[model samples]
Target: MDGIFDMLILGAGPAGISAALTAHARGRSALVLSSDPMNTPLARAPRIDNYPGLPGMSGRELLAAMGESLEEQGISRVTGRATAVAPFGGTFMVSAEQDVYRARTLILAVGAQQGAKPFPGEAELLGRGVSYCATCDGMLYRGKRVAVLGLGAAGEKDAAFLERVGCQVLYLGPTQAKKCEIKGTDRVTGLVADGEEYPVEGVFILRDTVAASVLLPGLAMEGGHITVGADMAASVPGVFAAGDCTGRPYQIARAVGQGNIAALAADAYMRKEQEKQK
Candidate 1:
């Protein structure tokens, strides 16, 4: 329980599970954080006829195969929605419900993302201090301060990105304020355990950011598609989004393919960081 992971993959669909397998194969300690099966689009995708290696299979059948692979490989599966990512100390923090997951690197394999919450201030603050992509906002806090209200690899990585940008990051909760690592009046002042109030200029909420549907709106979305840069990475760093979430070719093969590439990019980034540490 005191150990930190080398990688934590989000979602347990084809993309996320694939990342977990890849990271584990490379000798990295990894975990897959996911919401319930009922929450994923795959659950609704009754038939799947496009995946390679499998001419025809139901989404459920494919999901089961992947699930079996995860078990066969001994990768831990944390069934919960990742609400936020942040940096705490030199490691990353992820928030989901009452649980807290940590890691050194992250892989966002959330495909066809969506937001499930419809609350006030949720939409207005997204990416305006309230962010989903840690790589994008991490640098914005250079030599400054920020607050991340999330848990798990997502929140931990987001906070790590903030730290990368020189931001004194404070972690809230993917659950609620009282259960957070940091708490204050209406805003986070400092780490609760440390009891030191650090000035904060922004607070990124992870509460409503789990599915591709929710994350889609905040991205460079046109109708439903996400615009990508040359490298297929989003405008955010440490955050390379692919799969159906990009809203481009909505096919199983494409999602699986993009997921593989994204995993590689994330792996490469983590390796680079490891090299720097060496």
Candidate 2:
């Protein structure tokens, strides 16, 4: 698909969907890549009370309504996990498992970064020998021994890709140890799992969600949340954030409001970029 969008939104929850709606309403092309079902956490909740006009409805009901709205509006959504987002030629490039997308602006509305409990030496060896995206960094370890701690289907797919690329892949399944250690002096040398050590050149920790910092290098964060201003613009230029990923007050109404702000900010940023080009 040679699709180039005006705004590329990560996450399909209220924030991401709302951002898409706003962008589209403003006559901008938008695409959303969502791995999780729309607001899975919210859908599991028995009821939500704070979101006005949709009061007392079950979370699942609210999610269904949101889905229908997005469908009615003809918003495009790609059901894949985004591995990385990189700046390219004043725009952005988003990489999923099977495809890459281009956009002039980006919105990081991917809810919260869950299930990223750090392993020993994981932080220190980041980019040295430890990585989050196998698809993005797998080639760096071609023909080298690597350990992949995968959480779900995405992890399995990453491991398979590594194997296909001639890398010796030691895939540790869905069960991740709470305290596995990445052992090495300068770079990643091995991984200690369940009290056993396996010599490896790199460790790829593939989970469903990743820290924003890992997704876009140099994207500023505060205490695990993507730092955003009142307009929902993030520390990185041309990037905006909304929903739980931006931080708490984790309410549906708040998420939707922030999503609107982020979309408007992205629209303004795109206009500025266009003017500069002209």
Candidate 3:
């Protein structure tokens, strides 16, 4: 687990699994991370016909087949929601709760960010008083009150961790989170929820899927999709994006195709990097 991976794909959907398969074929060590593999949108689809060679197959069936493929290929899978991805030296650091992974190349196939939009000042005050990982930033608010807007089990764990860290935690379940508002100047100061305001130093927003932009800072985005080139390489070097997070035409075939391209692109990037390091 301490060894740096050649490619770290975020998500276990068709795109991510495809990327991992390709990476393995290319002889690269790849890791696939997903918080809730069972909850992937693909798994919810009753039937998919557009994908060739798999007519009349259920989404979950296809997903299971891909899982089996990964197992056969010996690709590693990790069950954790990635909170942040930051550049570290010539590689990258991916943080997921208590674990941190290092990779020379990154493939953001984490599907699309769904549900509620960001609150009024959430984006602008991201580092100031807003955070996604309670474990990563909870200690900064020690002895201070903070609001945790959690979506599922991951969010619940984040809130509990904040409490354990000595932060007076205000747990706003998913339903209440949608009605919450962040209010502050220069930094987070209060949270508005359910027609009531509570004083807090920071607000932690934890959800199953994180936006591509939020996951990797400085990555170019176009209307909620990660900007990519013809080779599937993202704006950031050593980073690639595929599937729904890349753009429209949300089809299984499209996602799988993009995942293939991303895997190849990552392999090429890693080769160039290794050559430079020599």
Each candidate: RMSD: 12.1, 3.3, 2.6
Q: Which candidate do you rate higher for lDDT, 1 or 3?
A: 3
Per-residue alpha-carbon lDDT of model 2 for 203-230, expressed as tens digits? 9987777668878878888888899999
Ranking by lDDT: 3, 2, 1
TM-score, prediction 1:
0.61
- Pairs that collide in candidate 3 are none
Question: CA shift at 14, candidate 2, in angstroms?
Answer: 0.9
Looking at model 3, residue 150 earns an lDDT score of 86
Residue 235 CA displacement from its true place in model 3, Å? 0.8
Off by over 4 Å in 1: 115-120, 123-232
Top candidate, metric TM-score: 3
Winner by lDDT between candidate 3 and candidate 2: 3
Indicate the TM-score of model 3: 0.88
TM-scores for the candidates: 0.61, 0.84, 0.88
Give all candidates' CA lDDT scores: 0.63, 0.85, 0.87
